[model samples]
Target: MMKLEGALYPWRFRVVLGLLGLMVAAICWRIIDLQVLDHAFLQGQGDARSVRHVPIPAHRGLITDRNGEPLAVSTPVTTLWANGKELQAGKDRWSALAAALGQEPKAFAARLEENAGREFMYLVRGLTPEQGQSVLDLKVPGVYSIEEFRRFYPAGEVTAHVVGFTDIDDHGREGVELAFDQWLSGVPGKREVLKDRRGRLIKDVQVTRNAKAGKALALSIDLRLQYLAHRELRNVVTEFGAKGASLVMLDVKTGEVLAMVNQPTYNPNNRRNLQPAMMRNRAMIDVFEPGSTVKPFSMSAALESGRWKPTDTVDVYPGTLQIGKYTIRDVSKNEGVLDLTGILIKSSNVGISKIAFDIGAEPIYNVMQQVGLGQDTGLGFPGERVGNLPNHRIWPKAETATLAYGYGLSVTAIQLAHAYAVLANNGRSIPMTMTRADGRVQDGVQVIPEATAKTIQGMLQQVVEAPTGVFRAKVPAYHVGGKSGTARKATVGTKGYTANAYRSLFAGFAPISNPRIAMVVVVDEPSTGAYFGGLISAPVFGKVMAGALRLMNIAPDNLTPADVQPAVAVTIPRGLAR
Candidate 1:
């Protein structure tokens, strides 16, 4: 029995030793494979479970005015995020989490449930740092805060239409914001990060994509002039009880828009009650019949024809004339003849029509086109309207006559201002821009002869200085020259016009000897008894130009106070004899 037990032990020991040797060999092979042949695969699997590719948000660019005043800017903000799965695991503590986040417990739980499959979800966005820190104090699992940026407009509603506003995703939605979005938006970056079980960022491993910060943009708007225009336009719109109003002031020499304002504007910072209508930059977008404002351009065309002189007389007998079927009449009574300058000063529609008919349509069309009618201002502004001027080749006699007197053609306020700027620049038409200039004057297209421009400029001065002229547009201590226009509003969805609804317009320049500013003001559908451009719009031009000149420290050409008339009181509704 002892001999049999010893043999059995030896056999069992051999078998156990062989099995242990095989197990050790297998373990060694696995270690070799993991450390050498399959190291990258194993490392990738481990990283998938713990490491993450996180986004590094970049800051947006700043927007400033010509004077370096901040118009649109971005500030750091905190955005709350959560790991839904981890948040769901702490359902028992949801009430505390909800209290910290200012949310109802049930709703918070439901939200977690809705995003149960999501690894990350936004809890709330745009929180103050204090609010975010309070959230962190809760120490709720899966709750986190991401650094973000929120847009802020320092000028608020004052520059809203120009600076515009951005959306929740930091994209510009209107105005210069949208126009130069690509130039203003930043490029985000990515980095490999190590996260803990609770989804907190443990360590940054390496940068995958480098972030590129956005470049700053400087605009041509002067905040000082912008405020002036905004305040004056609002006041005039309210005083005249008009439907709406728009005004644009330009640096005549550079064609840089100094100020552009539209009434009924919206505050870009607070867009809680934003309306689509309030987003329009009306000076560049809205088009209307310019009424008698086109007279200067027409007169320019006539002078260019060499058939009409500044002193040539046109007989406007009884202030009415008949074309094929349409009867052209002046707003006021006239029994005699008017020279070229008198025609503009009195705004005689019949006299201008006769001049347009004599010169033919092609010449007038050429002059208007050269002066920037029927063309874009090249401002690249969003929703800018290129006004309508029909091809002169197809003009009927009646249409031609109407076109001469500022009807049957459409123009925007900016277009009118551009035309006046051409005259102000002594017949050189510089391309308009919305960006800051380098103080170098660009060569421009010579639209009219310099001599002709000077003659017309003098005539326009008469429109301000003559007793029958636009007295309201006369600025103190400056030689102001402008034309007043009162055109009946063309009915929408129809071809006729409304007698009561009028678009009052005034287009002119200040310090006429050496023109510094050319501006245009349009008051749409004035409901008050006083609806003439001379009554409502001219006064606004005078006040704004006076303020602008003083602000710019421009030397007044007419220092003699006696040459300037007393400030006219426009509160009362004057009788519209015209």
Candidate 2:
């Protein structure tokens, strides 16, 4: 019995040893497969469990004005995110997390429940570093904060319409922001990271893609001029009790937009109550009939036709003229022969209409087209309107007569400013730009002979210089020449025109001897009894232009003593005069 028991025990031991050897072989195979044969697969599975491919955000570019002053900039901020499942798992930490996040515990839990399906969700965005660090110090599981950039506009609402604002994703939304979004937005990068079981990043393994920072953008806007324009436009809009107002100032030599401001502006930084209508850049996007502002172009056309001379006279008998069924009349009675200069000085629609009809529609249309009417300003501004100017072929005599006096057509404030720039630049049309000039002079298309431009400039000078002229546009030490226009706002949907609503506009240039700035101001639907362009719009032009000219160090042309009552208080200085 002892021998049988020993043999059985030995057989049992052998069986146990064989089973143990098979188990060891299987373990060895698994180790070999994991460490060598299927190493990459095992490593990948391990990485999938703890290591993550994370995104590294790149910084957005800076936006600066022509003077290199920051207009729009990106500041580093913290965005709080959470792994919903893990965050909700820590019931004890919920109150602490809610306290750190400035939320009620129950409400915070409800928010988490609402997003329970989302593994990753934002708890807060654009928190200050101090605030984010405070949350981080709470050591809440599954909660994390990432470094990101938030756009800021230093100029605030002063440059709101021009610089625009960015979305929460750091994408540009309006104005220059939207226009150069691709140039301003950067490409993100990727990296491998080791995360703890609670989803906190423990280590960065290696970078898979390097982030490219966005390129900086330099705009042509002068913030100083921008502020000045804003202040003046806002003041005028308030004083006139107008619905809104827009002003544009251009660098006549460079075609750079020195300043552009619109009243009823919104703060780009505080966008909580943003209304899309208030955010619109009316100067670039809205169009109006231009009223007598178009008369300058008509006079230019008349001069270009080789039929009218600056000194020639037009008899505006009874101050009214009938063309087909339409009757054009002067606002005030000056029922007598008036020279071209006198016609402009008095803003005589009848006299100007006579000149336009005599000159023929083709020449008038050609000149208007040359000065950039009925066309886009080529600024590429988002939502910019190409003001309506119908083809001359469709014009009846009545429409032609109305067209001659700044009716039957529409123009944006930017376009009106551009047209005045044409006259300021010696009848040369230069493409406008919102970017800084690089010392390369742009060649302009000669739309009118320099002599003709000079003649019209002299006539416009009379309008601002004559005692009965647009004296409201006169600057203290500078010669300013511009035209004013008041037109009934065309009624929406259907329209002959709104009897009560009028668009008051003034467009002109300053330092007449050497024009440096061209500006336009439009006050929409002024409620004040005095809705005349000379009253409501001209003063805005004067104030903004005077400040801009002085800021630019432009030499004042009319340096006559303030006390002296010269024959002409301000004249187009002889060197530039015809």
Candidate 3:
């Protein structure tokens, strides 16, 4: 069987050897391709499977008052997360994690079961440093944590209205927070995370972009002044048994708001007990028919328009002035003639009504509009209201007349204060602001001529200085100047004013020699025997003004009272009596 031709045997052996050589060459080519050409791609796939993105929370910015007092800040904390897939692989691992986190094992197991197959899941958020350490000590597989921040308010309820509060993600929600939210929310950063086979974060692989914190916001509020105003206003509210109260202090030099306070305020740190009404900033939002506070504007407009003089006398009927179908009456009986200054000192509704008719609505409306009434002050707020102003075109005969005596129009406390500040600044109506910027007046648009403004200022001073006028507001050492207003509260169902409930307002500028601080105090529905501005709110004005001036280190106009004497007892005309 082995005896075959030599040529045939050799040919068959050569064929078999050639086929083996081809097979070996093919194997070598495959090995070279796999080892060299495809290595980078395989490596890239492995990296993708293991890599992750870990968010590094940036620190929130600080909020400080103008005096550099920290109002809001961020405290460092930790957030715990888990790898659902890895936790499932480790039996009872969830129970261990929950035990270390002080959570119930049953709840932890249920939560993990619900989130099975999830790549990443949060176990707990906002962990304290101590809690974080406990979690780290457990060394439980799949559990990871990273640093974060939580906002805090140092001043709490006292500064809540001004500093406002931020959301869980550190976004502003109210007050300065909302006004400057974009500036307060810093950009979050990202880093590459190294993960194990089961998508558990091992460590940060590389930082792609560093987190940038928000900018610190400096407010114009003075903490001391704010505290003072809050204390006194709260005292008065409790004394009068009022439902609530509001107080605001403005820098006369510029329309800067130094202190704005509202009662029933809520602490930003614990808002669970907050009331809806407590959150409203009444100084800027509440509108009332400024009562006698508006008399100065009327008297000023009349004197400025070259229509009346301080001594110019107008006959006021004993009881009422008949206009169209409505008869406008005074609070007290004054059957005689009253000069321009006398009308303001007496707060005669009938006298003011005659003057409003004399000046007409156009000029007064124009001046009021120019002085920032019936308009927004451009303050950064959520819901600022524009007070109502009766258009001259729509003003009926009675409406125009009533508007002169501080009726048929409405204004917020801030607007009244701003108008008084304009009078203090010698006729220039400066724009009001919340931020503590430059204190220089904005060269206010001169609504009334300088002469008219000065005259009104002199009359307003007399209202406080005169003996019979309403001397309840005079400070012992300071040269006080201001006006008192008592407008009846509007009845809900009917049209006429309520007899018992009245909005008492006293607005003025102090240190008449050189006005430093302007203030307006309005007490709504005061239950005390006296609801008139002169009796109720004017004294508060005097108290607050004296306190504010003393705090600001302003010298008194008269060290002693012999330099000035109580003028003639300018009894409030019977018609103007409330």
Candidate 4:
């Protein structure tokens, strides 16, 4: 073998050796460039695909009732997102992803086409933990899930108008949510994270910024009272076949809204086919001619004037009065004169009109304004209506007469409740609030004399005590003071009031001996059967007040009550009756 040919064979071996040497030299040069010359650049390139600044979600505030019962709260949820660029390689697996998202394959494919150009895309939002985990188990490239919040209303439609709701992105959209968005939505934080090529989170590197949780809001509603009112109002509306209805109860001492409920309400949790009308807080937003509910205010004005007395009477002979083109009439045709208390109990529009003309409009106007009619309640509700009250020192006989009997002027259910509160609070106009006061909050402005309020309370009690009065409004063992109103609805896009359509209302306070609560019930356009305040609305007031009184632990005042009196009290005045 040593003696073999040394010509072509030796040259071939030399060629192989030279090639190996060149390969070793090239490896050394590459090592120098990576370790010294371009080290920072190479390391940065490696990190570019892995390092990420991720958002750390912050929770929204809790909205609770005055008794610490949760009305609205934010629960942790998951929102799935995708890195569109990375997901392109896994297009074939999209059908599986779409199935997890509860989407049709063709629909999901079409959506992908629209979002293909984007670097990131939202896949599904507001998913439960199990729902989100099911999709993530697929391990599809570029798919990720982030924690978020979904608002939940515990009281459902019962507290819908007051608690409101948020959008998919956790933004407050209505009710108290819209009113206090800034205070309820806190700042989101950020963190440094390491992710794999598929956009899957590998590790949390460090917290870049800490998240700030939202502030908790305590509302003025009492959950027990709210539930009671909601149940009673819904039952009445359904049974009466009413177009709409509203009920508001107030803590006369604190001026706090204890319970406010509306019929045809929408559940904030599931607002898929919600109508705009269903979302209105009708207790404060919808305005109507209060009908005879405002007669209490007229009576307040009468008592405050010193020109009229409880024993005074008005002539309602034919039960109808001709004031210009308008004809005011009582529900029943009367043959004799009536006292002030009798006029209110019978809801005599003719009798009330005579009193208004006798006293002039100024006194009635002043008392109505003082008791929060024709003005906003100052509660700052989103779509609250201020109502209408014409303030003219010189009034037409028609306008003044209509004002006395609860027409020509407009008011909201809450406004009527507030006015009754002034009477319940011993003639003081307390500042109405939707938020709970700390302790012993006494905010009041005098709207009438204490003696006048007490006297009116006694007179109102007679309205519920008389056999022809609102027998339905009388709580079993409570001294209820209430007024009934049956107002003809103004024809839509017309001037005159409609005959068949009516707004039934009953505003009253319980435990007249020591008034602590005032409530108003309004049923609009009762479609079937009775539409009078004494029939539909007064029954709701009685039912709700019965439950509310017991739940609030308030003592009943009618411990030693008198028998039901005769309807007609024929006390004649010197010149006022007729």
Q: Write the per-residue lDDT of candidate 2 for residues 208-280, one digit (tens) a residue.
A: 9998999999999999999998999889888879999999888888898888999899988898998888998
lDDT of 3 by residue, 294-350 (tens): 778877778778878788888886858786678887776584888888888777888
**Candidate maximizing TM-score:** 2
How far out, in Å, is residue 16 in model 2?
A: 24
Q: Which order, best to worst by TM-score?
A: 2, 1, 4, 3
Top of the candidates by lDDT = 1
Candidate 1 wrongly placed segments (more than 4 Å): 1-31, 92-110, 206-210, 561-578
TM-score of model 1 vs. true structure: 0.90
CA lDDT, candidate 1, residue 142: 80
As for TM-score, the candidate ahead, 2 or 3, is 2
Q: Which scores greater on TM-score, model 1 or model 4?
A: 1
Q: Write the per-residue lDDT of candidate 1 for residues 389-471, one digit (tens) a residue.
A: 98855778888888888888899999999999999999999998888885868899898999999998999999999988889
As a TM-score, model 4 comes out at 0.87
Give the Cα RMSD of candidate 3. Answer: 9.8
Give the runs in model 2 whose Cα sits over 4 Å from its true position.
Answer: 1-34, 104-106, 561-578
Candidates sorted on lDDT, descending: 1, 4, 2, 3
Which of candidates 1 and 2 is the stronger one according to lDDT?
A: 1
| Deviation in Å, model 4, residue 137 alpha carbon | 1.0
**Candidate 4 on 1-578: residue-level lDDT in tens?**
44446575786777887899999999998889998987987888878989999888898989999999999888989899887777888999999999989999998988887787777889989999899999999988888888998999989999998888899989988889988899899899999989887667799899999999899999899999998888888888889899989999999898899999998899999888999989988888888998888887888888787889999888798888886677877777584799998888888888888888888888999999999898988887787889899877679898899888887888898889999999988899999888887655686888799999998898899999887777999998789899988888898797987879998899999889999899999998998888888899999999999999999899877765354555897888879876
